[model samples]
Target chain A: MPKPLLALGCEGSANKLGLGVVSHDPTTNKTTILSNVRHTFNSPPGTGFLPKDTAKHHRTFFTRIAHEALSTAGISPSDLSCICYTRGPGMGAPLSSVAIAARTLSLLWDKPLVGVNHCVGHIEMGRVITGADNPVVLYVSGGNTQVIAYAEQRYRIFGETLDIAVGNCIDRFARTLGIPNDPFPGYNVEQLAKKGGSVLLDLPYAVKGMDCSFSGILAAADLLAAQMREQDRILSAEGGKLKEGEVRITPEDLCFTLQETVYAMLVEITERAMAHVGSKQVLVVGGVGCNERLQEMMGSMAKDRGGSVYSTDERFCIDNGIMIALAGLLAYETGFRTPLEDSTCTQRFRTDEVHIKWRDD
Target chain B: MTASTGSQDFPCVLTLDVPFPTARLASIALQSLQVDKELSALVRRTFSISSSIEGARGDSDKILKVEYKATTNRMLRVAFNSFMESLNLVVEVMEELDADVLSTPIAA
Candidate 1:
């Protein structure tokens, strides 16, 4: 029997910094996750995390997180076969910060470095966790939104966002409502949306063939929120809650409406992709994939097509190092190692650029 | 400790060794501070993290070493001041909100 290969992964392409350990046994083609630790840099309400600030956050926590992941996995640096890290398709500063740490670890341990694409990491991890052989993937996150499928050594992007990503739209709306960012603005928005009672405000629903746009919807929602704020101030000064039929719009209503509209658009595109590829299974991954509403909508769509929808919980859905480790380990086993000089991170890395050597058919 | 007097080729040089509790903290500082784009054509900066050999003996202390070179003393001072502001914020964030201080349960 061939020996098991262990990999250490580092990921900080956005506000969250993560470290994880994964092992793969070639004899059985089984993968095991030993440890996955993450620390997020949540900005205050009404603000977004800047590249520089997020980079600083990754730098401050990378070492400690790496240490914790190693200890949790019960392995020392020498026990790993290679170090893996997210190489790009994210904010430049945060990506470089994590890359520098990975380079340092590679030098210290004399281990080869494996640079993995951020999107492919999410896809591979989803497949491993959900045990889905081949599914049309719906990837939604703060930085990206896309529907992908595998074909001839590439995960082809069938549909994607034309403007700001879905999670970004939710986060910006949460900011407009002054929601707390501790757990994540999107999760908070989801909680608030539960309080709303099907009061769908008229927001733009944009789906252009296989792609969607959120910027227009975001603008309209922001205007509605502003109008609500102005009315609230006037009503409060008059010493009364919203009177009957005064176009009452609460933050909860806005959140509910936004979630409904956006998830519908996502489902529309994902369904289109599945039908085009003639696939029976659909997989959802990325940070925003944790939303139950999206999963539910996709589930209904797949059910109508006599298919099934697969998704993992927040642990695997959201950005984490384990995904990077899994993807990089696959690449490493196929005889791939990034030379130190060529190990630089980039702000834009396309998913289809990667040659999917680990899979056939 | 000491500023390197400039030669004809490179005029002024300033070096700083900022200490942190651990090598990780120091490396974080180095990585964050190293991303700043050089504002002036006349100035250049380099940053690195160095752990004390005493760390191997159990102390575990590290330092972020930064060096700046400029065509003139005024330019060097200006760039150095801006760098210090960024460095201060980075260090403050590390001290107050790092994973060690904000050890909340992972919401898996």
Candidate 2:
């Protein structure tokens, strides 16, 4: 039997720095998650994470996380077959921060380096974890929003956001509400949205064929939040009672409406992609994929079409190092190694730029 | 940046020499650090490898030299500060994951 291969993956695409080790058997097509560790940088409540600060967070914690991941997996540098790092499609500084560490490790252990695309990493990890075969992928994250399907060795984008991403929209709204960024703004928004739905506030729904827009929705939502705050202030001054002609509004209602409108837009485009590609399985990946409401909405939509939606928990759905490791290992198996000179990062690497050589279909 | 002579525009300048234990390590550091181009047009930077030894063999090329020239002292400070962050990370990784990290003492 051919020996099993092990890979170490480093991911520092944005605010999160993740390191993981994975094992793959050549003969059985089996993959084992050895150890996956992550460290996230959360800025203040009203501020988004800056590039330099996020990069510093990754730099400060990378060595410690790497040691923990390797020891947790009970392995050393010599046991690894290759070093894999996220190459592009993320913030440049954090990506470069991770890439430097990956390069250093490669040279130290005399191991080959594999540069994995971030979107492809999410999709490949989703497939492995959910065992979904040829599913239409909905990749929703702070930096990206796309509906992708496999064709001709590429994860072709059928639909995408024209402006800000859905996650960005929600995160900004969370900031407008002064929600803390302890875990993530999206998660906090979802929790708030669950308490809402007593009143469905009106918000713009922008879905154009295979593409959608979120900036308009975000603007409308922000305006509604402002109105809600104004109403709250008026009610407080008026002994907790609004004027006879005025209607009460709450922040929770705005959150609920935002979730419903944006998720409906995503489902509409995803349904179109499924029809266009003639695929039944739907795989939701990326950080926003962890939202229970989004999953429930997607689940119902898929069920109506005699299909099912596949998603993983936070550990696999969020930006992680294991996905990069898995995707890079697949590429490494296919004889793909990024040369040291060519290992550069970009902030705008699109999903279609990579050719998927691992999957035959 | 504070060292600016105020002689002309872009007067503030700084040069940094980062030494590694081995020539190969120094080259690795240079290759890894030089990939990311400086983001600011106000800052001009260059990277080169040098050593004190003349025509040094295996381990003679042991210094990574980085020079910075910016329009102002503030620009120089910001640019070199970021560079130092990256440089610190590289050295840290070398200490943690380098092959020699686990060298065991030999007993007679």
Candidate 3:
């Protein structure tokens, strides 16, 4: 029996820094995850993570996390085939910090380096975890929101957000509510949304053809939140009694309305992509992919089209090291190597910019 | 320590010399550290390999040298501090993955 190819992956493109090791069997076409460890840097409530602080956090914890990942995987440096790291489409400082670490590791271990695209990592990992083949991908997160599908060895972006991403809109709204950013802001908003059936408060639906806009909706949501606060102030001052012609609004209503509206826009774009590509499987991957409501909505839409939705839990859905390892390993198998001089990170890498050499369809 | 700068107007200058086991390691460090340009316009930085220092004896080159220059002490300090953090991380990875760590029972 031949020994499986092992690769070590490093990811610090955002608030989270993760190190993982995975092994792929050439004969069986199976990927076995040996160890996946992550450390997230969360800012205080009502505040989003700044690039400087987040980069500091990643540098502080990178060596320790890498140690744990290697020890947990119980592999020696000489056993690994290559070192993999995220190369772009993220915060610049954090991405550079991780890239530096990866370069050091590649040189130290005497292994080749493979720079993996961040979005391609999410898409490939989603496909592997959910066993969804040739699915229309809905990639949503803090920095990205795109409807992607593979065509002619490229994950083409059929539609995307014209303004702020859906997750960004939700996260900003969470800040307005002063909700905790740990775990994540989107989660707290989702929990709050569960309690709100009050009336699907009016919000601007910004879907335009296959693309959507979110800033207007976010502005509208912010105004509604201010009104809710004003309503609370008035009720508190008026002996806790409602006025004759005033309408009641709550934070829960705002959250529910935001999720419904933004998710509807996402589903519409995803369905359009599915129809355009003639694919039935819809795979949702990224930080926002962990939202059950979004998954449920996507599932319903897929079922209506005689298909289904595939998603993973927070473990694999959120950015982590295994995805990079998985994607890089695939690229490595196809004789791909990121030369040392060119192992740099950028902030504006597109998904379609990468050649999907590992996939033929 | 202060390193010579080509421009006299940039008075604040600092240099760091990090020794590695081999010249290849020193070259690797230089390559990794030189990729990201300084974030501030007021700061300028450069990296190179320095060999055969006075009292250094090794199988390969003596040091990987990094120099920073800025118009103000505050700018120099901010940029140097960030560079030191990344440098420390690279050194730590080298310490953990190479240099005798791989042969050690526990680290392996």
Report per-candidate TM-score of chain A alone: 0.98, 0.98, 0.98
TM-score of each: 0.83, 0.94, 0.94
Query: How much is A144 displaced in model 3, in angstroms?
Result: 0.6
Top TM-score prediction, candidate number: 3
Better of 1 and 3 by TM-score: 3
- Stretches off by above 4 angstroms in model 2 are A238-240, B1-12, B53-59, B102-108
* Model 2 CA lDDT for position A343: 82
**Candidate 3 displacement at residue A342 in angstroms:** 0.6
TM-score per model for chain B alone? 0.81, 0.79, 0.80
Query: DockQ for model 2?
Result: 0.63
* lDDT (10s digit) by residue, model 2, range A1-361: 7887999999999898999999988679899999999999999998899998999999999999998898799887899999999998999989998998888888778899999999999999999999998999999999899999999899999999999999999989898999888799999888889999998888988999899999999999899888888887877784677768765777778889999999999999999999998889999999999999999999999999999999999999889999999999999998999998788788889999998998887
Any residue pairs clashing in model 3, and if so which? Answer: none
* Local accuracy of candidate 1 as per-residue lDDT tens digits, A225-247: 99899888877785766667777
Screening candidate 2 with a backbone cut-off below 3 angstroms (N, C-alpha, C), the clashing residue pairs are B1-B73, B10-B71
Q: lDDT of all predictions, in order shown?
A: 0.87, 0.89, 0.90
